[model samples]
Every structure is written in structure tokens, then in C-alpha cells.
Target: MTLTHFTFCSAFILGLMGLTFHRTHLLSALLCLEGTMLSLYLASSLWSSSFVLSTTSITPMLILTFSACEAGTGLSLMVATARTYGNDKLHNLNLLQC
Candidate 1:
């Protein structure tokens, strides 16, 4: 109901829409995936902050770390696709052909 929550939800939805509409470009999909992950991270952090518990949680850090790894992997895939196919179009990519 809060502004931050609304913003986070909007960002997440926009990222999903980007992924859906930009399915042709690998780079765009990667960027959208990162955006989705970032929004999830922000929302999780906000939710965690609402709990005034005795112990601290590292959920946000873990989410960030995994997102970074996912981004690196996606970038590597994009580079490989570009080098092999001359473009980053997902339609031209055929992993099963190899």
C-alpha cells in the first residue's frame, strides 16, 4: 500500500513486460531480468525491515549476489551468441543444434 511497495511492484511488472516484449534481443532480456531481480531485492529488503527481530538476516545480500552471478552468466551467453551468430537475436540462437 505504501509508495515504496507500489514503486517496487511497478518496477517488477515493467521488467516482466520488457522481457515479454523484447524477446528477440538477448541483451534486452538480460537487462530486463536484472531489473526484475533488483526489484525483488528491494522489495525483500523492505519487507525484512518491517520485522524488528533480534537476529539479522542476509536474504537481501544473497539475492544481490545471485543476481550478480546471473547477470555475469547472461552477459557471457550474449557475447558468445554475438560471436557465433553475428547478432544477439534469440531467434538465431539454437543451443540444441550444437
Candidate 2:
């Protein structure tokens, strides 16, 4: 199989694993999501012959930083929700209201 094919297949698997483990903890789920993103970045970079420093790579890096910010925001929201509700578990998160 070609390297690109392997890269995409592995990324898909990682994303699935992230979905599967998402119920365990909010932070863990976020990390798994990041792993999926990384796999996607790797796959995308493999598209060209030489993985040079170019605008294509720059966009994904920006996206990764954006995702990092998103994760921080999500964590803060999770903390606030848990503190207000007295539990951080995902099952208990449904009862929260704005």
C-alpha cells in the first residue's frame, strides 16, 4: 500500500478511537480529538513529494492552534459546569442550563 493510503487509514482509525473513548473524560476526549487532527495533518503533509515549509502546512498549524484554544475554552466551560452542578461526569452534564 502507498504511504498516503496508510496515513489516511491510520487517521481514520485514530478518529474512531477518539469517538470511542470520548465518554471516559472530557480532557481525554479532547486529547483524542487532537490526536485525530495530528494524524490528519500528517496525512495532508504526505500529499506532496517534499514536505516543505509552505502555505499549505501553515494553514493546518493555524488550525491546530485554533483547536488548542477551543480545547482550553471547552475545559474552562467543563470546569464551570461541574462546579455549578457538583459533578464533572459526562452523564451528569445534561442537566445544566444556561
List the candidates' TM-scores in order.
Answer: 0.88, 0.65
- Overall lDDT per candidate, in order of appearance: 0.90, 0.70
Expressed as tens digits, the lDDT of each residue in 47-78 for candidate 1 is 77887763435778889999999999999999
After superposition, which runs of candidate 1 have C-alpha atoms over 4 Å from their true positions? 54-56, 96-98
RMSD of each: 1.9, 3.4
Worst 10 residues of 2 by lDDT: 44-53
- Superposition TM-score, candidate 2 onto the true structure: 0.65
lDDT of 1: 0.90
Question: Taking the tens digit of each residue's C-alpha lDDT, what string does model 2 give over 5-85?
Answer: 886888769777876867756667666777776776666556532656566667666667777787788789779867876
